[model samples]
Target: MENGSDIDLLVARRLQALRTRSGMTLNALAERTGLSAPYLSRLEKGERQPSVGTLLQLARVYGVSVGELVEGRPGGDYHLLRAADATAHQGRDGRYTVLSGPRAAVSVMRVELPPGSRSEEARHAGEEWLHVLSGRAGFVLDGEPVVLEEGDAVHFDSGRPHSLANEGDGTVTVLIVSTAAPTPASHPMPPASREATPVTAARRPAARDR
Candidate 1:
């Protein structure tokens, strides 16, 4: 894993690629995205971590999903990204790496949930498949909490409010593939609350090492 920097240069490259593929100059893209040219330029250069909300806006303008904006070549008979090329992104929610180019039907992501950290509560249209790759964590669906350990996996509808938490003392890494609807195509985003609120789970027992 490339963890030398917080900036995900892969996202930077992909953003520039998508914009170039559409034959749009930075100025044109700025006009289309309603984002200032300088800010967009920073995003393309990996100088700033693009927030989920910002990615949503760019996705709509590029006719793609937030996942697509962070992935590899996008579409083809097959998609492959060398391990060294994978970019790790640090976000308000947590650290994640896009595992594949967003498909017409699904988006795959590898997420890290730090101990005592909880992701923002979010609900969207469609379904989700989650597999715990390491450590133990809590997956909250609506108001119920389900504890999962390494190798545990679950698939469920994503329509109900849901969030993930690393209630244990160690971080949990999960592979999430979702076919859920992204922020609606036209919902206005509040700059103040870029990502919904992240709720901390009540203190709980830490998972013992395997």
Candidate 2:
């Protein structure tokens, strides 16, 4: 996995690219983000790292989520995914395997939840569809409980508060697809209290190793 410095550099490059693509100069971006032009220059050169707040400001200025700006890639015509080579992102909650390719219009992942595992309630910007692959799972959407067993599926607007838990003894595995791009703001995002960082059972892992 790439280290923090590597990610910083990658984000720096992305920031530069976004600014250039929007035909904005360092001073212009500085004025919009309330940051200094020299600091942005250093950031663009990877000489300095930005805080989360800075990233949010830049994301807002760019009219994209912090995720879209940080993970932005050139659009392409085709892409593919091979299950055999898929990397599983594991965390204290569970693990997930991304099923969508870079160019896929929708995002997808195979989520695994061990017995008793539960996710914190969160909300985002798009709609999500989930199909149970095995075992049983519990979903609380907009404060209503919904249970699903093998061969069951549910689709709901993700902007509503929701949480999940493994309801069976065995592991629960499900396929999740999002109609919109994933964003850091999708969970515990803007206009919501920022006391804690957003986290979902099957979402992207933290930028650093635990």
Quote model 2's TM-score.
Answer: 0.55
Candidate 2 lDDT, tens digit per residue, 119-205? 656454456687888987998776677677677777876656667789999999988776554343223233332333232233212
> Can you tell me which runs of candidate 1 are displaced by over 4 Å?
1-67, 71-74, 181-210
Clashes of each: 0, 0
lDDT of 1 by residue, 28-60 (tens): 877655577998899889887664335545765
- Say which candidate scores most in TM-score: 1
Q: For candidate 1, list the clashing residue pairs, or say none.
A: none
RMSD of each: 7.4, 10.7
Which consecutive 10 residues in model 2 have the weakest lDDT in total?
Answer: 201-210
Q: Candidates' TM-scores?
A: 0.60, 0.55
Regions more than 4 Å wrong, model 2: 1-75, 182-210
